[model samples]
Target: MAVRILHTADWHIGQTINGWDRTFEHAFFFKELKEIVVREAVDAVLISGDVFDNQNPSAEGMRMLFHALADLRRARPHLTTVMTAGNHDPAGRLEAPGILLEEIGVSAVGMILQKDGGLDLSRHLVPLKNAEGVIEAYCLALPFPRASDLPTLTGESAKEAGSPIVRAVADLYQRAVSGAREQIGDAPLVAMGHLHVSGGDESEASERRILIGGEHAVPATVFDESLAYVALGHLHKPQRVGRDTVRYSGSPFPLSVSELNYKHGVDIIELDGDSYSYERHALTRPVPFYRLKGKDGLLVAEVEGALEALELDADLPVEQQPFVHVDLRRQTSALGLRAEVDQILSRYPVRDTGVSIVSAKEEGQAAPSEIVSLKKLEEIKPLDLFYTAFEKEHGEGPEARHLELFHSVLAEID
Candidate 1:
């Protein structure tokens, strides 16, 4: 019998689009995910990381997560879920309810710590068992390792340790794999990680760089050929690392405008004896993402025309509507243009809107000119200094409202 698993990562449950809440989209995605789990008859689900958009997630976000997990568990009582902590997650918070969640067949590993100041391999290794109580596979659940999470080397040992942080992380995986081999005989090994792997394509606008001293990404060689599959996270774009077996399932939703072109989905892995095979399952996006840009000569008019031509179904829920990002190329302030665009989009069924203006004249160049003043720090007023910097960047002085806010901040400081 084959053990089936559904792999996903970077749900970003508390994420927002231009200050607009995305609770509905998340709920809809979960509904679709639940159907997939049931339809596929998956034995286990692995969420690599970034379960929330921020470390300090909102109350609504927490509620949605618990409810979603409950629904998944209710659908399949024997189903097991393993979620690790990414850079966006608060490890301690995610792991606080670990004991209770483990009782319900959900293992959440936030931070891996050493027991008695030594590597405790048991904490990071999890064995996957079938409904009949047969151990079929073992998973090395390695969460995003912080600087503190890695084992420390001091005194004599520090001298011999080359790249202590990377070495400790690699050693952790090695130890976990070794332990799994000993405990579960002939069971296919599956490793889950929430860190950047060498050669993985990244979405700069979405992913937070996890590199440390320019030496963060771990090589795929650390995983070795012993592991049947490696589920990775952090990178928002789904891709392979060194081989197809070691891959990132990617984020379930587009976290940024730059990620609009990505085909968001999940991975399905089938474990048969010692061999494993996997396939990508494309997800039904709750909301379509689109980017519309204004041409060189027809700046505002082009943007307006595009917005007017967008076809949307008003009968559907707002979450199902399109998300529009309008890019304008202009010489003057495009701030006022936002209201005009909003007015036009208001007639449509779009859920959210964002406007970005790039100067047509200075398209690929730096700011018009550099501030070459030689004034000392104490010689200038804070407000004037702010105005100088703002003018240099935007090619305009600060507005009345901006000045007011600056004064208010100064007053508060005083």
Candidate 2:
């Protein structure tokens, strides 16, 4: 019998974009995921990690997570789900309702614990069984292990020159793999990890760095050849580690502008007998993310043209409007740039679309002037300070109109 599984990770629920809530996007993603699960007739679901954006997620975020899971279970009563906690999640919080969740065939492993002062190997290991109650695969459900998760080591192993965190993580995986092999003997082993793997490409803009105890990544070779597949998380780009068998499913949505260009999706794996095959399933986003830049022209005019060129369906929902980042060339002053951009955008029907302005000037350019002496806070007037800063940046003090505006503001304060 073939065992089909949907592989996904880094849900990062409660995540926001530019201070705007993204709850609608997450809801749409879950709706699509449910459709995929039903269409594929998947027997199991493997969610790698980063289930929440932070350790303390909001109530709405928690509600969405539970509702999504409940909907999935209702759609497929025979489905089995295995989820592990990522660095962003509070392990204890995620695993608090473990006993209750298990009643619905869902298993969550937050952190590996010591039983009787010894590492409990069984906690990280789970057997994936079919509806007929037959064990088809053995899964090493390893969560993001902190310094306290691993067992204490002595002798030369503890005194290794490299990072102690790396050594401890490797040791934990080694023990888990050994225990799983001993229990199942080789029934297409699968391992789930929420750590950064060496050689895996990362979406730096979106993924949070998972450095702990001075250790950032683990070598891909640590997975071993015995495992049929190594499902990984932490990175926000779907990619292979050292080999195709070991892969990251990435985040379901474009979490940042860096991830906007690539196709976002999940992996569908079919494990039959001793062989396993997988395919990527692309997801359709409710709103497209775009980075817009002006060509060689006046900043205001360039912004106006770019916004005008975009063909958006105003009839669509607000969440369906495109989110854009506008880049403009250097100007004499950026005083009214945001207002100008907003004014141009308002002409279009995409009022709900978010727009951010960025200066195209190269960073780290030398200032036009240098300060000769530092003045004490009480010694310098507010207007004097503003003029000095403006001269240092623009090679000149405030213009007559700017000085007039400043004087009027002072008059109002008086």
Candidate 3:
């Protein structure tokens, strides 16, 4: 029988959009996900990482995750789930209940442990079984590696391979795969990770840039060829990198407007023997996103008129109402933008994401404008602000080494 595994990532269970709670959306996703597990008869579920939006997720977020995991296991008694920690997760917190969670058929790996002064290969290795209860595959349940978690490398040898970080990642995977093979003895191997692989599309507004081991992102080849399928997280858009077998299932819903068109979904990989294939299943968006503008661009003077002229579903409950974004021509007083948009939006039940103004002088050039709610500008990350300031002062962004130093110092502070 072909062993079927449903792969997904970037849950961000406690995530919020424009300061709005996504608990309802997450609940909707989980209900459907449980239904999928039951309907498809999946043998296993692989959650790559980013289980929670922030390291300190609210208690409600934890409860939601626990309930969802319990429900999934009950939906398919034989279904095995492998979940790992991502950059945003508190590794220890996610791992604290590991032993307890195993009772419900979940294998959560938050951090790579140590044993006798070497990496703990056994902790990262997990076995997957078919409906017949026969073990058919092995998984390297590796979590996101912090800088300290990476293996040390030095000298010309590390340099010859590539950046030390890239070489270290490749080395870690090689070692893990070797150890897994030593024990599993060639049952097809699969793996999971949470990192920015080169070529994967990113939604910069929501995702964080986690620089580790002196590199901002690593290449897809960091995975060993022996891994039949690699489930990845980090970037919000679902995509394949370097090879089709390595893929990201993307987030289940839009986390930011930059991801407005992203196909939020799950990927099912069916593996039998040495051959495998995958298919994507799109999830219905619980809340719709609307960008209000004319073919040219909505004029600021017509903003109220347009708001009055639009039609929206009246049956949608206030919480499930569509998210609205308004666009206007530049030169609209930034000072009055929020008041004007708020006054107009107050008439409708929709949630306003923000207002953006296009530069009229550069009509043909399409550039994404900063949201008019000073909140967008207020949300500028330290790194981004530093990058802009450095470029303005030095005619260029900071060099990689400079960035690496900054990342290291910041990590220490955190």
Best by lDDT: 3
Model 2 residue pairs with clashes: none
What does candidate 3's lDDT look like per residue over 35-144, in tens digits?
88888889999999999876666789999999999999998998899999887777878999989999999999998776776568778888899999988888889888
Question: What would the TM-score be for candidate 2 when compared with the true structure?
Answer: 0.81
Say which candidate scores most in TM-score: 3
Q: After superposition, which runs of candidate 3 have C-alpha atoms over 4 Å from their true positions?
A: 158-161, 305-310, 360-414
* lDDT, residue 96, model 2: 91
Runs of candidate 1 with Cα error greater than 4 angstroms are 153-164, 211-216, 294-298, 315-317, 330-347, 358-414
Across residues 109-169, which tens digit of lDDT does each residue of candidate 1 receive? 8887677655465777777766665767878888877766666777776687466666767
Q: Which ranges of candidate 2 are over 4 A from the true structure? A: 116-118, 152-155, 294-298, 334-339, 346-414
Q: Rank order by TM-score, top first?
A: 3, 2, 1
Residue-wise lDDT of candidate 2 within 1-414, one digit each (tens)? 778888899999988765556888899999999999898888888999999976667788988988888889888888889999987776777899888888777888888776664456577677777767677876788888775676667788779787666777777778778776777786888899998999878784455346454356888877878888899989988999898899999999888766877678999888888778999999988877766664432366776667667876677766666776665555677677666776776666553223334442445764342212212244344655766687678764444345446656766786
Model 2 weakest lDDT span, ten residues long? 367-376
- Evaluated against the true structure, the overall lDDT of model 2 is 0.76
